[model samples]
Target: MSSSQFQLIKEARLKNNCPECYSNDSLELTIKQKLSETQFYKSITNEIVSDINCLNCELQIFPVRWTDDIEQVVNYHKRGLNLKTKSVALKPISWGIITFFTVIIIATILFATGVLVL
Candidate 1:
């Protein structure tokens, strides 16, 4: 059976106050990605999720729960993270598709020219 996997893309701790406990230097931000694959199927990926956790209050704070002050702090910290990325890699399924088309075109041409005996 085919299975799916998850990966951590970016994780940064934001030193902001917890809305519940009112403590500083207790918030953490995590960004994750999910990759999925199956038998005879194309691989799918590039799913992302962002979450914020508070150490002081042990609560998961959603974006709607953030106040103005929290938003500013979060944005400032996000700007500093500054991660660089490169080009994406094609999956095995893509290569297989390209090869299949090439072979079909070649076979068609050869048969039309009487070069292929089939």
Candidate 2:
């Protein structure tokens, strides 16, 4: 994240109106847990880092971009919260919905044609 993005997120967080901000607490906890699970830091070169802090929550976030220039990048990984993607159980629910609608449509067509007999 850049300084601008950090400021924006911080403002949004302070407002406490955005869902993302509301989840920040839980997100931070998860991030801590993830950090404990494995080594999360990596440095390819020194120059490709960027550091930005949230204005509202004052959370320091380090977001890094890989670049050839090592001197230009700061310690970006230190300033931001790291999160992981949670496995969502959507396949079953999605299939169920499709099946449900298919059945409804078929039944409706049958009833409309008098084949379903009420």
Candidate 3:
């Protein structure tokens, strides 16, 4: 079974004020990248997500609550982020399974051609 998770890519402390609490220097921005994992392989996907929170208020600030200043800061931080590339890596078990199947197929072919004897 494959499982999907979001891994933290970046966290930035912004000087923008929280619209709800009206507190300055309490806003934080977080970025995450999607990761998929299974017994056979692990992969990083291109999907990215972000969240904003207020440390002083201990509340999550959704986009709907963002002020213009907060939005601008978030946009700046997002533009500066260095995101990871999407990639897949196979596990040892997956390699072993592939090798086992390849050997079986080769053996079968050889036997059909009368090149392999029992």
Candidate 4:
């Protein structure tokens, strides 16, 4: 069974005040992708989660704690953020199926032309 994993998609540090610790330039925002494979199948699903942490107090900050000034600053930075997303890659099982079909067709062709012994 494949276990679910959280991969860091994007990480950015903001020079903003931490509401919890009241520290300046200690906030960090991170976006993570949680990937999980379906049981008894090769299908995989991905979900996104965002987190804000304060390095000074080691506290997790919430959006509700953001002041108006902080909101404006976050919005300004948000406009500059270029979030690039990538499509999921094809699994090895799909290539294996294609190869199996190709080999079967080749074997059939060889047998029909008497090129394959027995």
Candidate 5:
């Protein structure tokens, strides 16, 4: 089975106050991108997500509770982010599987045409 995970792309400390704790200089913002992995290949996807947490309150701050200023700062940081390009990388096992299938197909064709006998 394939698995998907979020890999950290960027982390920044924000000066905004946490709505829950009302503390400044404790808010942290983090951005992450999705990665999918399987036995055959690993892929980086374009899906991106962000999260905010307060160090003082040790709590996660959801977007519903975000103040206007906090939202603006988050947007600014997002605009400046340099995200990774999406790509896929095949494993050695996958290459072996492809080679095996190719060889089998070619041999079958040759036998049908009488080029390969017995």
Candidate 6:
């Protein structure tokens, strides 16, 4: 891992405990790095997860990452350091539903027109 990747993982591991896990007996953090390429050059991505187990309950939490004028990730966990009520965007599910229907419709049309025989 690169220095930046190590730093990100270290930062995530040192973060404070989850508010909901106040009564938990154990908590830990695991970090991972993924490399990718953009239009310019290669970049390192970081992902951190807090593993907590307490009172017969287990959970994982992640921190928020954002840049100027851009929001990368959103916090939607049930309990955490900054607990609050907020809007949760379920856009991915909507897109999946639309895409499923569109694909089926297109495939049906193609089959009916004998353009696609399988």
Q: Which candidate achieves the best lDDT against the true structure?
A: 5
Residue pairs with backbone overlap in model 5: none
Candidates in order: C-alpha RMSD to true structure: 3.8, 16.5, 1.7, 5.3, 1.5, 15.8
Q: List, residue by residue over 1-118, the lDDT tens digit for candidate 1.
A: 5677655666777776788888888888876566665644534455556778998889999999998887887666555553434224566777798899999999999999999988
Model 5 Cα displacement at 6 (Å)?
A: 2.2
TM-score per prediction, in order, is 0.64, 0.27, 0.87, 0.54, 0.89, 0.25
Q: What is the lDDT for 20 in model 3?
A: 85
Clashing pairs counted in every model:
0, 11, 0, 0, 0, 0
Residue-wise C-alpha lDDT for candidate 3, range 15-87, written one tens digit per residue? 8878889898998899999999999999999998999989999999999988888888888888888888889
State the lDDT of candidate 2 residue by residue for 1-118, as single tens digits. 1111111111111211212233222212111211111122222212222333444454554324222222122223234534333322334556787899999999999999999995
Q: Candidate 6's residue-wise lDDT over 52-99, tens digit each?
A: 222223554323322221111113221233312222233455568878
Candidate 6, residue 39: how far the Cα is off, in Å: 34
lDDT of each: 0.73, 0.34, 0.92, 0.72, 0.95, 0.40
**Model 3 per-residue lDDT at 99:** 99
State residue 109's C-alpha deviation in candidate 4, in Å.
Answer: 16
**What TM-score would candidate 3 get against the native?**
0.87
Give a tens-digit lDDT track for model 4, residues 1-117: 666766776777888878887898888888666666543334334456667899999988877887787677666655555554534455677678789999999999999999996
1 versus 6: better lDDT goes to: 1
Candidate achieving higher lDDT, 4 or 5:
5
Runs in model 1 with CA error above 4 Å? 1-6, 33-48, 82-97
As for TM-score, the candidate ahead, 2 or 6, is 2
**Global CA lDDT computed for model 1:** 0.73
Error of 6 at 4 (Å): 40
Looking at model 5, residue 2 earns an lDDT score of 94
State in Å the error of residue 27, model 4: 1.7
